[model samples]
Target: MYVVFFYQGLATHLSAKKSALEQLDGYRLRLRKSEEEFHHKEDERHVVAETLKKANAENSVKTAVESDGEEEDEEDADAGSEEDGSRGYTPSPTPAKSRAGSHVSPT
Candidate 1:
């Protein structure tokens, strides 16, 4: 748009200035098209990055939930074993783990 006035200021021959203005307009159009393509690709990249982040967050949450559930199950099993031991119930055939140094014979 500036060339609309710039051409008037140029002292060069009218034909030469007109040709130059036309070339400038073509270059401007190509630059604008290139910028549009660049912006579009940037936007696509951003969307993909956001989606990947969301997926990772979801996976992290799910993994934490599963870990907590497994820990609770292990706790329940350990509590049940402790209760049986305290009550002096007969040990299961699999046997309980012996305490450290319990194999020492009394004098």
Candidate 2:
């Protein structure tokens, strides 16, 4: 009778150890899944940040182009005014003025 009880107790202890090992395995699997989810979310965030940076750079280039065009137009207008100012007008000589100046001699 004593030997039978000792064997039964040993079997019970082994069964309990097996149940604990199964629970630990389940917890380990859950932790791995959570870590994978965290990495996936981090990758998505990086992609979004890169896209936004590209968009902002494109917008800045477009703004610079538009500003350069406006400056060129202003310069063209100023050059046209300067050209007009440089050309002075001259009056034509009349027939009476030519006849009077023809006989005039300085001594």
Number of backbone collisions per candidate: 0, 0
| Per-residue C-alpha lDDT of model 1 across residues 30-105, encoded as one tens digit per residue | 9999999999999999999999999999999999999999999988887887887854356578867878855877
Q: Report every candidate's CA lDDT.
A: 0.88, 0.88
* Candidate 2 lDDT: 0.88
Per-residue lDDT of model 2, residues 3-93, tens digit only: 9999999999999999999999999999999999999999999999999999999999999999999999988877776788733334577
> Model 1 Cα displacement at 46 (Å)?
1.2
Model 1 scores worst on lDDT over the 10 consecutive residues at: 83-92
